[model samples]
Target: MKFSTYFNDWLYGQDGYYTKYRTIGKGGDFYTAVSTSKFFGGSIGNKAISTIQSGFLPSDTTIVEVGAHHGYLLADMIEFIYTLQPQLLDTLTFAIVERFPHLQEQQKKYFKESFGDAVKLIHYNNISEIKLDSAFIVANEIFDAFEAELVYTTQEGIRKNVVVTNHQLGFEPCDDLFLNAICDKYGIRQGEIALGYETFAQNLAQNIKKFEFITFDYGEKYPRNDFSTRIYYKHKVFPLFQEELNLNELFGKSDITYDVNFMHLIDSFNQAKIKNVSYQTQLKALVEFGIITLLEILKEKAGESAYLREVQKVKTLLEPTGMGDRFKVAIFRKESHA
Candidate 1:
């Protein structure tokens, strides 16, 4: 089977990791910015308000989150937005784009418990289902979750893709025109390339007449020469290609992920008529979104002990050698083509 097929099943199949067993935070396979601090979501809430006030988005625009795990990020954003601008809640609608029924139930339960009857949440099974005139879309660590294809160039300049055969992963030449063209266009000889970004972008372009899109994920703008795919099992990192590693034993049990190639990602959206507004490190983006100001407000309202505890957690989101520098924030905008 092709690696993308194998990968998609392992992470998203009916009984896949995300479908039944995926967990996030310190106890799970990994920690996301959402798990680090509510301030992460709070910062984004600030940006949302600014966008609406600056006339970039309408007041009634839906705040949509794609691949919202447990709906924590969106919930936190709503909480912070309520704290900052409760009046805006009267106009804005909230929604989550989640594919799996089980995950959707989980998100619904979380939202209900978090806000009770105060907020009305909409659910969609796919991006293509969103039929909004305008939207403010946010996706955190979502691109890395998309199925990816690994490809490399041969000595004769032939392109080959990685696949799973006989329970072992190996590389072979294939007839994937899209991957071939993308590799050639970007001068990418070898790396794990995310699939479906163009389709995802195009779906948003077609479904939502006007939109502002923001996503946070770990990656570089340029393609990496070396493979970045790895496995996370109980917070322990395992190199995907390590010899003696049993691929079958880890199937559907471990989280498999790779760094994104943002250049390819931005270009994909660009081709779909969604233009990128900015791409920057998580540190810069969070600071600009007023994470520090939110922290100060918490310190004053929540007391010193609570403030100290939260600050330490927030540091992980802004740590120089860690999430701060490793993760990136990409923002894109699309106005009515008509």
Candidate 2:
């Protein structure tokens, strides 16, 4: 069976696809930036504070977080907000949007134990239903999850819907309208394969209004050959993996993600008429706003080693060749509704 077909069957059926993913943790398939260190949350929290202060009335602001895995960052933001501006804490409401049921339950458990009823948890299967008048939206590593159409260009013309159907999965060309539209928009010529992160990013930008968007992900601009139709399973990167296979079985129940093009995101933001967009690494943004200063304050509450580790993690986020450079942070702001 084709990899995509197998994946659809396993994920849709009562098989162990979702069950296996529910158990992903510290020793699971891979560790996210959040799991790697607390500094990631601390640095992001610092950015969130600056964002909130710049546009909204803290007393009536709603901070919405998409793909809020484990709720650690949300907790960190709450603490940071309290420390910086105590008055905003009482009026603040946090809405965590999580898709996975098991993870949502875990988040609830953590929030209930630590924050009581202060935080509001919302389960969303799609982004279309999220309604907001004036809010600050944050999505970390969320765009990469959008299912993308794959196209391969040849001397003859652009081929669409490339699928693998051999003993081992590979690419076979098909005629898909959506894929063709992407090719037309991007001017991807014959003899080149292109993925559809630009289309997905543009759609997301058009959907939401009346808020500042801060997205963290990894990708590059156009004319970049680094992004291929590939899959990462169990920390192993594979170029020929298709969507029809049992992802959990073939990849050891890991999370499959794609690289996001930051330039495409900037273009989308401009198309949406969301003026005032800033792009930087997570570490640079944190340091500019004094994340080290926050660490010093945390050292008094926690131990020195814990504080230092957090600072180091933030520093790692700044390394140009490391996550700091690989991962790009884009911030978009609209005029405040209030």
Candidate 3:
């Protein structure tokens, strides 16, 4: 079976698809930037307002977020916008493209309790359902979750790692339309290449007419030396070889993601006719929006300890030791000026 298909079975299948398992908190498998600190979303709002006021978007601009979990970032973004630009909130749209029913219900409940009729919400089962004319979109840690292909580059060419049924479940060399495209794109090369093998980006581009879409993921065009594909289960990192056939039993319950290959992402947008694309690290993106000023305010009003605590929180998003270099942000817009 295709790796993406396997991912969908676990992430959206009736039994395996869930976020409530030891996930998203102290007892969870992992913590995101939004869960780490309010400042992360707050800083996003600080720039979102500028984007809205810059007169590039329409008055009825819809702000859509894919892979929004529990509405934490949405809540924080709206709150920050409310504090700084309250009037604009009255003329905005909030939409979430989520597949999991549980998370959709949770986000719906949050919006209902928080904004009432003040905000317009449109929920979609997938990005293909989006029919917006223009919008501002934000997706944090979204692209990495897409399925990836583990291919061993041999002297002949690139061979895909596919799941096959032998004695039990084992991996074998398989080729399909998707894998063929990967080999054609990368050409015959030697070395192990973990291609982020999903079409979610292309699907999103084909659906949305024009959007100021932004995605934050971890990956690079080139690697320095050691490159490996691993899985994370409640913060434990294990190689793909270890799981083998048992990957379904293990990773099905946990989050399975891979480092994004931005080249593929950029190519997808270009194919979909999206223009004015740009990229930046999470640290530079946050700093360019000016978060240090916010830190200074906390320092004067609160104690130094509180300020230091805030600094630590900001570091998680900015410091290279953390998500700074690990996470990257890519922006795609319809116009060249934006």
Candidate 4:
């Protein structure tokens, strides 16, 4: 089987890692920006409100989140938006695109516990199910989750794909024309190649006539020369192809992810007529969203000890060598309705 098939089954199939794992916080397999701080969502909320108020998006635009693991980010975004402009809540509808019924239920339960009847949330099984004239879609670490093919170049400049057989991983000459074409186009000789981005973008464009899509994930604009796939287990990182690591033992028991190729992502959305509005590091995005100002306000209002604790957590988000630089934010929009 191709590595992409193996990856999809291991991470998203029945009894897969995401299907079985319930924890995603400080104690979980890994930490996302959501788990790192509420302000991550708060910043997004601020941006959304400004976009709506500026006439860029409609007043009743549906706020949709794709791949909302446990709904923490969306919840926090709603909370901040409510605080910033409570009246906006009356016209906005919140929705999440979640494929798993169990995860959908978890999201609903969390929302109910957080807002009761104050906020009504809608759930969709996939992007194609979303229907709206105007929408503000947000996703964190989503593109990286799409199944990617592992490709490498041989000494003779021949491209080959990784395969799994008899519970062992090996490589064979690349036979897929599409995979070869993608690598050739991107000048990628050795790296993971994600498929289905074009279909995903097309689905969004077909269902939602007009929308702004923003996502945060780790990757660079240029193709990497080496593989960026890894497994996360118990907060420890394991390179997927590590010699000592047994792929069979970790199946359905750990988180698997890869760095996204932003260049390819942008091109796919562009083909769907969605314009790339901006691309920047997470650090810059947060600063533009006024996270530092929020902290200052907290310092003035909250006790010194409480403020200090939050500052420490927020540092994890802003540290130049950490998530701050590793993560990139990409924003796209289709303003036909405007």
List ranges where model 3 is wrong by over 4 Å: 17-22, 155-158, 164-171, 187-207, 223-228, 243-249, 297-306, 336-338
RMSD values for the candidates in order, in angstroms, are 1.2, 4.3, 3.4, 1.3
lDDT of 2 by residue, 1-338 (tens): 43344334333334534433343334565556666666566566666677667755344667777878678777777767767776776766677777667777877888888778765655655555665556677787866655444455666763644344433444566565655665676665422332444553444454554677778777655534333444555566655344455533554244555566565556666765665467876656656656677778888888899887777765666678667677777787765331
Backbone clashes in model 3, listed as residue pairs? 22-28
**lDDT winner between candidates 2 and 3:** 3
Displacement of residue 20 (Cα, Å) in model 3 is 5.3
Model 3 lDDT tens row, 42-155: 777777777867787765688788888888887788877787778878788888888777788888888889888777678898877887777788898876666555554445
2 or 4, which is superior by lDDT?
4
Candidate 1 residue pairs in backbone clash? none
- Full-model lDDT, candidate 2: 0.60
TM-score of 1: 0.97
- Residue 322, candidate 2: C-alpha displacement in angstroms: 2.2
lDDT on C-alpha atoms for all candidate structures: 0.91, 0.60, 0.69, 0.91
What are the per-residue Cα lDDT tens digits for candidate 4 across 1-338?
A: 98998999988988788886469876789989999999999889988998898898988999999999889999999998998799999999999999998899999999999999999999999998877889999999989989999999998998999999855889999989999899989999999999899999999988998888999999999888899999998999999889888888888898999999999999999999899999999999888877887777777888788789988988888888888999999999997653
CA lDDT, candidate 1, residue 95: 96
Per-candidate clashes come to 0, 15, 1, 0
Off by over 4 Å in 4: none
Scanning candidate 2 in windows of ten residues, the lowest lDDT window is 188-197
